[model samples]
Target: MRTRAAFGRVGYMAGALALSLGLLGGCSAPSVSTQTGGPAVAPAQDRDALEAQIAEVTQALRALGPGVDPDEAARAARIAVLKPLDWAREWQVVDAPLVHNVKVVNGFREKGVCQDWADAMEIALHAEGFRTLDIHRAIANARNIKLEHATVIVTADGQPWDSGLILDPWRIGQGRLYTARVGEDDRYSWESREAVRAWTREWKARALAQQG
Candidate 1:
């Protein structure tokens, strides 16, 4: 009895429901891989490239302020660049990030979502307990449920979150890392995670009052 138009509407609604469920399960917007293949042990050339990046990041961290310790900068740079790559292999990330996230949510895999990477990175950096640096958690597109993303940011001690550098591993997928200033990243507008949580709580409270 249903017309073709009704069938199209049903299909659209089903697709939207899948997307909403995926996002609610801690996945973010789909991401394109910067590299073509899955995670692998860095070959000689890749190791050289990674070392070069570590040095570059170290230099940037040291430039944050005179109070930033050189030793801490080097250590943080190494961990920030290396841990995600290790996790990629551990998570068996053989597909694009969103694909991997679906597998994870469906019980085919364990963890490799954007939030997983962010949480692991934050925990590893926080464990270092650096005296001259601060590790922060941030969310982008927090007001948009479907497009939300989370990341780790690093700043000089006492500097605000926006002044930090974003270390995002999920954006590029396949274990490749992406780094940019919180203000300079072209893809997302960053907000402190704590602020977003507080705002969400207030919004939920208002909704509950309206229903009463």
Candidate 2:
């Protein structure tokens, strides 16, 4: 009986080993190790491609901006000055407003806060390489309301300066240029806002220097 029991135990041990092997085989595949030290990450090629695309788009946008219109591009040299500057963020010293106050709301400039808008325009013109002319004539439609109205006539060609006041910003549109040049009696008029026109050397020496 003891010998029979030993044989039975051996058979049982063999069966147990076979079952263990079968169970391990049923597991089928090995799991990829994702523990403390896993596989190396693939380089982020897609991320770099996206960044490169963004840079190209930005360059395209900047290239589109400096386009010239001959008439319009002429003001590129000075538009930076009259542009609505962020006084609060950049130039706290001057305190220019983000929005300009011209005609509608009785702007600080219109109400005589930093020189009548005309004088301010003249100063800007002078600074922007422009000169001015004061019209004391009895022209039918032109007027100054209070003072002898002065306007910046465009004389780039040195023609006989026929009060064709070429205020520059108006050049942005031919309509604006047309209207600013022809005022009340079909004569030309523009409030001396930031000048679009400039003065020649001859006029600069005479009009502005002799004023004050």
Candidate 3:
């Protein structure tokens, strides 16, 4: 009964300037770039792989057609993303132990591919049985992009969400769901970019990569 938000997807190369000390002032991220400066066009084979997977789940929705389940779509989107994301790795490439450091975790063609893919996955989720909404937490606001998370709300309008049971894939293994609050007293279930950067600095102090 807990309607929640989830985030997924990927894109090609994107570069943004790093600001110091977690301040908001930083060079803007370079426009989306792929090996050829174009979107990383999915190959026929990869598209086919997702096509059927998406189709299978889409076909499963009792109330939907052969291709519409938001939750399933979200699941499919995650599957597509898994081909590129390293859910197994903790730090998806940090830059010299600094927050706002440049670390390219997953982007095949590199156009904020993660965002694009995540969007698509949300569509998939809609095709399934769950109603989904998108949320974007700026990296500048959080520090690390992954740590600077974007999540999906698996509930539709008029559905009440449990402010205490939010789930974030990035911070996996934390059993209880993160509660979301709308006011000043909310403990950040979704951390801010500044917080992520600060955390990065702490990470470097404890366990930073020996080389760049």
Candidate 4:
């Protein structure tokens, strides 16, 4: 089966950079203007917290033993996503799109958010060569959608929806990643195929608005 990484390679980076630069739809979210010539103070606490978490994950990987070959990189990336997910909540403004074109900024956020999580995970998992999992951008509803979420859906035998193991790091607060079955979990409302297709239409419309 064709992997999502195959398709996302070119578009992903460009889209992410555009979103980060506040160039999406020519709309800029309110940000702290840096007009001072003084050097910006570093965020020491946040940096320390992130480093500690990475070290913790690295130590866990080491516990797998020297002889045992583990997918250390993938495990590390999964854990690292938590830091950005948590940071996005505080760093990002939860603003509804001024126009459909500008929603990409809200979805992508300044630092990282739900779509960013999914996009990053999708890129990471693909790079890790996970043959059984596919990344899906799952939305909650079809009409008047708000804050659409995303996750990596794990399949048991490389078949879509065969088993629903959702890896969603943005569903809850704190530094924990939320992973669960699609329908069984209350953190997200899983959309059906029809609903997903409809949501895609809306998503594309938003994207087009940015392009125009």
TM-score of each: 0.83, 0.26, 0.27, 0.44
Query: Could you say which candidate leads in lDDT?
Result: 1
The residue-by-residue lDDT of candidate 1 on 1-117, one tens digit each, is: 999999986676556546744555333434543233654446667888999999988988887788999999999999988888889889888766666665676666788888899
Superposed Cα deviation of residue 148, candidate 4 (Å) = 2.2
lDDT of 4 at 145: 28
Model 3 Cα lDDT, one tens digit per residue, 86-204: 32122232122122132333222222212333354345445544344322222222544422344333322233332211222221210111222322223333444345568879888
Name the best candidate (by TM-score).
Answer: 1
What's the lDDT for all of these models?
Answer: 0.81, 0.29, 0.33, 0.47
Clashes counted in candidate 2 amount to 6
Instruction: Pull out the clashing pairs in model 1.
Output: none
Q: Which ten residues in a row have the lowest lDDT in candidate 3?
A: 170-179
Where model 4 places Cα greater than 4 Å from the true spot, the runs are 1-109, 192-195, 198-212
What's the true lDDT of residue 173 in model 1?
75
lDDT of 2 at 116: 30
TM-score, prediction 4: 0.44
lDDT of 4 by residue, 13-54 (tens): 456555544532212222323122221222566667656655
